[model samples]
Target: MSNQTSVTEFLLLGVTDIQELNPILFVIFFTIYFVNITGNGAILMIVILASRLSFCGPNHVHHFFCDIKPLLDLACGNTELNLWLLNTVTGTIALTPFFLTFLSYFYIITYLFLKTHSCTMLHKALSTCASHFMVVILLYVPVLFTYIRPASGSSLDQDRIIAIMYSVVTPALNPLIYTLRNKEVRNALNRKVRRWL
Candidate 1:
């Protein structure tokens, strides 16, 4: 009797069912990849560039991949340590954004009620922060749901749906949310387009 168990790495079967759909899938995903990278990268860049961009504090992140916890699944051997690290890292990544968003709105409300006492400014701030916060929550909650909890014998469909939610849907919605909600940004874009034309 052998007391050996085989461990295999999980392979991502990303929508390869219909052979005829390969090219279409490739085009679609390629566009999504571009949008996700560019959109997130641009937001990060803007945050870095703007001195006024405020957060609670500086935190050092120690994950190989920029996006967060999925790299832990790629560990070759015993994944205990990797899983622990991923949980800690992913938990912070998931919770901090939500907390900050809440705090931002809290301050905006406080500021509205306390200082200046103007409903218009408060409404604008609330509208702006709410839109951004909604997008952030939508992006992070699915990731936390998929990764943070203990892994169980679940079908790949669940994981695929989550991945699509965070990656494709979130990215697609980000530009629209930011553009539609922020009047300043919308006006700036219009001005830029007029200048270009």
Candidate 2:
């Protein structure tokens, strides 16, 4: 709690007060934990393996968590190195996709107005990229807000909400957005479900 004395580890007081609801909370969070790991892992795996996948260029992430910013705060030792590394790495990850998505749309719009463009292609690309952009914004904005600024004081509640937003909400939204906006993904999902049945 002082500049002279360094804290070794910070306690994550994550929803532990609700004694009766702990079981339910555990189940909910455990489910979300699995989903977050699997969903992001799946995306990373597909992106890594698919030679033709042409979104952003290749970058292997170095964070223990799905998003790296929060982990920086939890480090109680000398965080200067961790902070620098996290800022450089996660900042690039967060912003690069946003810029690429923006440029993609910029070209799409230019083509629509000035070149031989089909409304169908424009709509499809916009819808797909917009959904991705939305997810990226939702995931990264809070992280940037929480991590980029110097730590004033540690609030467990604030950290918990931000963690939930990035880990749980973002993962849940990915599949939902793709399923709802993408006809191909939806059809593929349906076919897979039917085959399983």
Candidate 3:
């Protein structure tokens, strides 16, 4: 809950200002989205930049989602505690998973190195993990930049752009990333395309 609040729904300004590109962007995103979902049942998701809004609003959110970071920009009163909470929660959430994921990769890679003598087999194993690692880095780097910092360090426009990377771009690219890396999936997809042709 916020103090000294104005009661109005926010006007959401989306990722870009150019009116002409919306349809083009929409179509591109839609195709990626369709492939992301259809190619597999599900691919990915994350939550960061979660913060309380303590705003006396003019009712404009300069982001597509009315995201907390943007709303925090509009917030009024003492927001230090809100910022602290945001940093703590976001840091804990972000780092824990990232730590676990990295640790898992380390052990897995170590096991592969120690247990396998075949250099070719090791290359194949590492290549398979590359797409997943790319997805992880794609997700975490933006998340870390966005939320794991003092509130003053965050820029709303940058936050919006980073949001696009993780939420829209990452998920959209996931099917391509995973499919291209996987020989079986790639062959199956190629076969399907050949049939259509």
Candidate 4:
């Protein structure tokens, strides 16, 4: 008889290899994972209640947080259904917001060019969308690179790098982008600074 056993669980390659660092890593990653869930869950809830978004699941994740690609990577049984959902359901979740954002900018540009015909207004509108657009690009480009292909082509190391790019780097830069580009945020910050002085 063949002693073939299927994989039932996965151990993620965490941030460190040192046994002593395990506890610290756990705490840090747990906090990050918790916040990631809380934040994304809030958005999911909003989408669910406001619109009609749904998700079904299996219970393994290769990445630190419950990102879709990582979770799919750990699917214990055949991943046909999971892959389908990734294409249809997850694709909708990921791409719809991007498409809508794109359309909004498209309309804004169209209105500015055809209706308004003001270079100053056009520049202002583009500038207003710039930060948001940059954030979207930062997030979605990596995601598309990671998920928009057949899973067989994905390298775990590559996925990890890109995952960090979208998950950590994009979120970290978002506020900076907003603050730098947004006069309103700058003014509010200046007001607070003056008061503190």
Candidate 5:
């Protein structure tokens, strides 16, 4: 039998079909890339400035953005150190907010149960948290599914789709969810339209 090995290099397709549209596509993608970086960078700066989040690393990112899995993928040599960092350092940084959110909600619910007999007040408190909770679920579930596993080349497309769910789809829907549910945002929008009119 003949021996065969898998190819090391692979090309991502369907991105550059028409030659004339190249610059237009480049401009569009560049704008998107710049916006994505600026927005996330602002958030990262806020988190680091406000909290104790820190990073020092072998700095070559594999994905379009500086995300955990992609950075790990780009690491040279054995990935043991990278994986350890992911498990310990990165995991703590990521999960701290989630844990704190849960803790705060637990306190809220406990207080509502023990102190409040009014169903109206309980419902109002829970309703406010519901929107935030939905957003958290939308973001975290897909991310956890995508990253918290053994990495391999076999499921790249599936991983990309799941990544898009949280990175693109969830963020796109967040404003809509907030605007629909939040009276303050709706009122501000209405006021702006009235002013322009």
Candidate 6:
């Protein structure tokens, strides 16, 4: 009988190699994970309620996708609990990653400054951070804006626009921003520019 294990390989850059930073990293990751799971678990209740409740009104979803708010709008009964659940989950999913990412950046900047004391290195680091943070801000801000407002105040048109921002714009920008930082990408762009010239 073979001792069967399906998992083949995995790679992990242990957050940080520094022993001193382990505790801080652990807490940050754990907090984000815990809060994220808890928020998602709350949605299960919403799902259960969706099945139990009688849906009223036109089946037409106002938004592009069947988002929680739009779905709840279709429900016959009062959706106070469902709305609250959606808001809470959205807030957690949106904010937790944003704040934690910033925290990581802060620590990285501090560490780099203290260790190297190189202005060029700091500038390079900040540029990378700025690009990443830009993406994070673009993605999270619109999502938070759409979800945090009072349900009554939610404009479907506005949401579709915001959805385009976070869903379409952010993702489209990610590869462009990150790839621009690569040496190979720079060379490729330079070649293209030279050919055009």
Q: Report the lDDT tens digits of candidate 5 across residue range 67-87.
A: 655654544446554554444
Q: Choose the strongest candidate by TM-score.
A: 6
Q: Once superposed on the true structure, which residue ranges of model 3 sit more than 4 Å away at CA? A: 1-54, 184-197
* Per-residue lDDT over 1-197 for candidate 4, one digit per residue giving the tens place of the 0 to 100 score: 97687655445444567889888877887997986786577556533432232335555455666665565455444555556545554555677778988998888877778887777887888788777789889988887787677887888778889988988999999889987776788889899999999
Quantify all predictions' global Cα lDDT against the true fold. Answer: 0.64, 0.62, 0.75, 0.71, 0.67, 0.81
* Lowest-sum lDDT 10-residue window in model 3: 41-50
Error of 3 at 47 (Å): 15
lDDT of 3 by residue, 21-137 (tens): 878878888897876574333111112222334457777988879665676668676666656666665686689889999999999899999999999999989987787899899
Q: Which structure is stronger by TM-score: 2 or 6?
A: 6
lDDT, model 5, position 103? 92
The estimated TM-scores of all candidates read 0.48, 0.44, 0.65, 0.56, 0.53, 0.72
Candidates' RMSD to native: 23.0, 23.2, 19.7, 20.6, 21.3, 5.8
Model 1, range 28-124, lDDT digits (tens) per residue?
8789798678656654543333323223433332332333333333333454554555555557656766788778778877777788567788787
> The CA-based lDDT of model 4 is what?
0.71
Tell me the spans in candidate 2 whose CA falls farther than 4 Å from its real position. Answer: 1-85, 116-121, 182-197
lDDT of 6 at 155: 77
lDDT head-to-head 1 vs 6, winner: 6
In terms of lDDT, model 1 sits at: 0.64
Compute the lDDT of residue 20 as modeled in candidate 6.
91
Q: How many backbone clashes does candidate 3 have?
A: 0
